[model samples]
Target chain A: MAEIIAASHGLVVTQAKDISQSSLALEADVVVIGSGAGGAVAAYELAKAGKSVIVLEAGPYVPSSEFTEDFSQAIVQLYEDKGTQTNADGDLMVLQGRCVGGSTVVNGCVAFRTPDYILDDWQKQYGLTNLTVDALEPYFARVEANLGIHVNPEHEINRNSAVLREGAKKLGISWKPFQRNIRECALTGHCLSGCATDRKQSMLVTYLPWATAHGARIYADTKVTQILAENGKATGVLAEVTDPKTGVKKADVSVKAKLVVLAAGAVQTPLLLQKSKLANSSGQVGKNFACHPSTFVVGQYEEDIHPWRGAMLGIYVDEWAHPSKGGYILEGGGAGAVELSAVTQPGLGEDFMDYMANLKKLAGIVTLIHDHNVGEISWDDDKKKIDYRVAEADYPAMKAAIASAVKLHFASGAKKVYLPTVVHAVVENPAEADAKVAAIELGLQSLRMVSYHPQGTCRMGSDAATSVCTPYGETHDVKNLFITDASLFPTSIIVNPQVTVYTLASYIADYIVQN
Target chain B: MTQNKNKAASDVSAALAPLSRRSVLKTGLWAVAGVSALAAGGFALLRPSPRDSLPVPAGLVHLEAQHYHLFSRLTEILLPTDGTALLPAAQVPVVNHIDGLLDALDPAIRQQLLTGLALFDNAAVVTHFKRFVDLPDADALAYVGDWVNSGVMPKRALGFVVTKLTHTGYWMDSQTWPMVEFDGPVSRRWGIPSRGNQPLPG
Candidate 1:
């Protein structure tokens, strides 16, 4: 808790120590909670539009200069719960960022526009008629241009991605390089940890800074305890400005605002709304949780793959990405030794040592399934209780996707393929992959799963009875209260959601400006 | 720390939140019979041992002597110091790192993890009549493997947590990088420039 407040370029940066009084109060035209993808964009747009904005972030501010490119350091500083948030059953690890820039600071930087099929599904099923591809195209284009979003060129496509492309071609699958929101990536392969050189266009280095430049005041390490509301209108927020490490309260801070925007990711956002006991007229505040439950298979090649030598993510196979075909995507994943150990063959003693010995020869391909909205988020005495079980209907698709990854590895000239299962299940030949995957259990913790994208917990739709927010991102029950995060997603977008969150937030910011 | 409790709770009882203490005790009894006991059962029957009162090493905040012994035994089996290994697990301060990690966790989670460690240690008492920490090297390895492949979700989860943390602690250290032929972190070495922002694509 040092340097409570700093002023530069029409911006004010404040920390908990800035307030000497037991309670500090402020007034702003707009107050945004959680400065990640949506919050940063909304803050920038509103502040640039001449609104006096105050942003409260519950996480600490560790700037690019502080980045170490070390997994332990990054997870401790950037990730929520130090990268250990999980479902109630503890089968799936749900990763969210907790810092000045939120998840954008720790995301893989894979950027994708909301797919047309996903948009169409929203229109047909959820009454999100205004959210058409053409309607949102301009916002997507602007965000892409603003962030320098572009496809990976030949140089950035390292051997790990090459394996994905070659395998997809051999198997007659459609593969393409990922569109990334980065400015000349250093190829250090630490996107999961954080971008050390300020190359990755995380909100920390992008919109948050842009907003601050436009006179948006930001308070880090401040946890909002309640949304002060009266007569169905949000008036302000009461927060505890605490030490980020010890959660020791330093002072009580309150912000009186004309408008309040919640962008605290899917889980935290819903949990906050539920905590306030506001904006739940539809009783859907913490319902309809959907996460793209992801698992991967590591392929061991005879040649040195050195997967960690390039971007953290690259090419992806979209042959079965469409809902009609199969709503799953296979991504070429790269990581350092610590992450590689998690997905590799699980064993004890020398057997595991021999596997780690061939680390340089290993590459991984990840599959993310478009799961159903069966998960729910609740709280038990302040502890986040996420009850998310992979739907039985989605199990076949999970197995199929993992099986496809196994085959792709063999087709890519891998000598051994390691499955992410309870026991050490390996497939030496492509022919045995199907039977092996078929036998893999779908029981809890039987398959190691992780989710970076947690969406649809607080859905947006035309029906007030079924949704927590409207199509324009306003809560159906509370006036001047808006949500602009992945929580507003009505369904899982079946891909990395940073770009889509940016687009919707950009669109919703315009709506707020107009209203 | 809320996140920490969830994770530790997840490991302690993958389905522990719903079970009553009585049910947990009953399940622990069942586990001793080699039956598939609920994961929470072990936590219910965990007794406070004299080891809990043992002294903790200096510079470590969370892990005590008993916890240290448990992790040290785990690393021996997972990443041994044998001739074929890259370096001895002892060379890396994995347990110390885990202790540092636990320092940041919620106290509830830390306590649950301790309970889990004690349960795992005492689990061997019924069959081998020896504490897991006192078991021979081969017995310890075999017992850990049984938990790894245990039909009980909690046991498997405990094994997963132990191995993941142990492997992460060891592999995260730079000393182990040479074994995997990894070029630690390249930003500083390569003088990677911090291109603040780039021009929009043409």
Candidate 2:
């Protein structure tokens, strides 16, 4: 089998032959810097269209067998900066997947179509007529089929998540099972730690392998430093071969191509463009960053409930996701033992242990809020770091979401409930919490929230004066260059961004092919 | 790789030949000394004591203690004492564990946690919990369980701590799993279930 695999691929190492020392010389039809959802989709489409392609990835090519269930090691290997905390006002912990599959390798397999309201808002406000829901539907459909997006109807609700349903039912708040991009998930709850079972249909298991099969070469541990340009047109890119061990400085490599696609994600894409001194004509390369701040609520049941034994996130509440309260969505989240241990705090651990000590009294739910546009992403000049600031204006939306979650838990008949507030740790009784709910209606202002979906750093618009890129994801100022990632989101869609990113990338790839 | 191999070989040879009691004692002393030196360096790096390092807001500690007492009492109340040999919630190891865990976190995280504890502070609310904890175990449990499920506390901290306690309790207490109809083993179970409806082993 090994010989057959090697013979079929003609040596995987040969496919990634080092072109660093050959100078910025050989020209290609297209160059994509990342092999994530966007980059992989773009590369596959372009390659299938008969365009020669080279993809530069900054992490090692980790096979499925290497994706262990060990959470700490998984974080170190797949996550950015080893899951480091960004001490923004709230000690905002940022987790971005950094390997060949990018975030798709580590993200919860929930696949949501870009919410229509977001597209409508973009079309109405940003004058982006090309981004209406109808226009993007076909692209979304194509990507969905390719990725095998589906709702897990028969996926058993583990004892852990069943408690969430029980609580919601008791509380009378509406909830529903979530749809994800997976096939035959084993309820292992190791999605965030990278699924070793090859069931979660992430980009790594889908489009990237497809791209590889179609002759697109992916060079891991090769970080692109700058997009090389000649007379205002992007010629290729200057990249360095990063060390496999330390990821520190190594040899330099330059690759020439007719077109370059920057899908290094929301943060790094802007940084790359900034380094190359491109896309600054509009001075909007890295601004208007938005994120969905999340908080968790837990309940203690008089039943054994091990929540970390199934799919990470299998349900969500979208009752408030319409235009009523400026749009909000709450989703369930799953964690392994390690992640669960890290999230649960000291005294709370004891309480949970005590409940579990009885083996019958613990359940939990996570509230993911689609907050208003009130954060900005700026690059620090001296450190070359991306600094994010959550504006005060969006604080109310977070508070409202928290309040709604608390109310839902009460209606769900949770015996003991806890809210994710910085000022209040636990409510000893439901009556007391209900009484204070009205007064603390906007509880989000006082509590810290986490964000996983970082978007809208480099937005798209019709005119070059106001936006960083055009509707086709081409930079308004730079020709022969395009962006296909969360960086181009005009607003924070009320859904996970991976599927949307793939759809947009496929659309842009087709547009590039046609033109 | 060759250098690593040579080092490994030498280390193995040294381990195989270490038979003298005097040499063993010397090696043990050296290991202890090295560990002590490392600990000292780590202590210096850690700097402040756990309590002092925490930046508890003005009224956070007292409120948290009050909440802690309330939680303990409520758990006791929730488990009915109708002549079952079940353990008392107050006697559960979770209370001490909670205190120890809070004391162990990074100072900054600890500080933020204290602030989270202070959000439920109306005079009446405080009085209600304070009085609730003094009630019989069943009543206290009923009250606190409802409060927790309603999401009144710091959502992340309370949920996290509760979940931890639940896991610890599961491992520590045999009664909970058996009573709740848990199908899986207590630990080290792996692999996907062949079908979602596979029955628990008798």
Return the top candidate by DockQ.
Answer: 1
TM-score of 2: 0.71
Candidate 1 lDDT over A317-421, as tens digits, reads 998998878889999988777677777545777778878888899999989988899999888776888889999989978988998899899999999899988
Off by over 4 Å in 1: A1-12, B1-57, B197-202
Per-residue lDDT, model 2, residue A52, is: 87
**Per-prediction DockQ scores?**
0.30, 0.04
Off by over 4 Å in 2: A1-26, A85-87, A166-173, A344-361, A381-386, A434-448, B1-202
lDDT of 2: 0.59
Residue range A1-515, candidate 2, lDDT tens digits: 22111112111321124534533344578999888888988987898788988888887776656665545446556766545433233235555778888888888888888888778888888888998788988898887776668876746456655556665667666777877877777777777767676677666666665665556777777789899877777899988776666445556677889999999887778878888889878888877777776666665554556666667676777777775664676666654333332332213323434433433344556666565555555555523343454455655556566666666655555566666543345555666775554454343223344566878878999878889999889988888899998989987886788988998999999999999
lDDT of 1 at A441: 86
Per-residue C-alpha lDDT of model 1 across residues B103-188, encoded as one tens digit per residue? 44556655776666766777776556566776788888888888777777667766666776677667767788887788766798
| Alpha carbon lDDT at A188, candidate 1 | 91
Clashing pairs in 1: none
